[model samples]
Target: MKIYDWFDGPYPARVRIALAEKGLLSRIEFVPVNLWTGEHKKPAFLAINYSGTLPVLELDDGTLIAECTAITQYLDVLDGNPLLTGRTPAEKGIIHMMTKRAEIEFLDAVSTYFHHATPGLGPDVELYQNREWGERMRDKAVRGMHYFNGVLANRPFVAGNEFSMADIAVLGGMIFASLVKLPVPDECEALRAWHARMLERSSVQEWRAMVERGQGVKTLPITADLK
Candidate 1:
């Protein structure tokens, strides 16, 4: 299998964390797609993913799986135990709900703010932007932080006692927020604490190391460990 992704990006990092949890990181090839260079928009890459998105998973049989959620679902079940998605019907429903909520309320909002309010990936990639809409989305992302704070205040994880894809969404959003300097609300202590815990994971630490190292346009050969 080959994983089409760019290092240090939130969406790809989400999938990376999931792969680490499943112990599949070393079993696949990592293909670096430079989004900054508009490589994802090129015809060659678009043929693999029409939406021109990163973090695409090509199976050994030549099947393409797109979207973080779908890819997570595929990886979660590979080992018989669905670690991130869920094993039961009730768990699946709750995890999916929280996952979507995190995407729409937090991650997606942060993405909008990055693309519109700020000069995202330069003027080349972002052809048009709406400042007013971006500001609104920023506010919504803050509200999302508050909401997740309240949710975490009652439970250990986003979807209940166990960690799920919902937590990955939160981590991804917070990572993006940090890159754009979006400060978390002071009163959202629970959300802040959850993010700190997430950073302790080996997968996140590996990703942070790569980001801090500033290694650009490098294709990493698969290794046994997260390092």
Candidate 2:
């Protein structure tokens, strides 16, 4: 089976980390879509993903898979890990729900703050940039963080005690937020502890090094295990 991978940003990095964990990184063709050059928005790329986003996966059968969550599910199933997603119907439901929460809360926050606050954070510095969009995104993120802190304060994982894709989704953005000086609130001790554990994962350690080695992030408030 062939995997046409397009990635160069935090969102796609989530898939990279996931694929790496499943030992699929070396099995697939790495097609680097330069988001910095607006390659993803080009006509050729848009034909694959009309939304013009990176991390679109083309399966061996010529099926296009879009959206981070959908791609995660597909890869997890194909990997036969069963545990990466969930072993039961109930588990899948909660995992998906929590993943959605993370996407809306932390992921969206990182996207807004990076594009608006960081210089040359997005594809272009002069065009397709929103000066105030970063602040708006941060505001949303701050509020979301408060809500997440409450939900996370009492749980070990986003969906109960089992580590799910939700954790990966949230961690991908939170790691970037840390890289860019958007501190994770100290009050969210649960989340911080979870982040620490995530750092120990082989997949995360690998990608952390890759992201830091590349010029991908603006800052790294704390160095996660650079293995």
Residue-wise lDDT of candidate 2 within 1-227, one digit each (tens)?
Answer: 33333334778778878777777766666556666666666666677677877676767677878887888888888846665678889999898888888878778777867776776535453356665887888877767777767777888777878777887888777766876778877787767777788889898887777666753222221112211
**TM-score versus the correct structure, for each prediction:** 0.92, 0.82
In model 2, which range of ten residues has the least summed lDDT? Answer: 218-227
Residue 222: error of model 1 in Å?
A: 16
Clash pairs detected, candidate 2:
179-219
Q: Write the per-residue lDDT of candidate 1 for residues 1-227, one digit (tens) a residue.
A: 78888887889878888887787877877777787877777777888888988888889887999999999999999879998998899999999999999999999999999989999888878889999999999999999999999999999899999988999988899988988899999999999898888889886776677667754224654222221
Query: How many residue-pair clashes does candidate 2 contain?
Result: 1
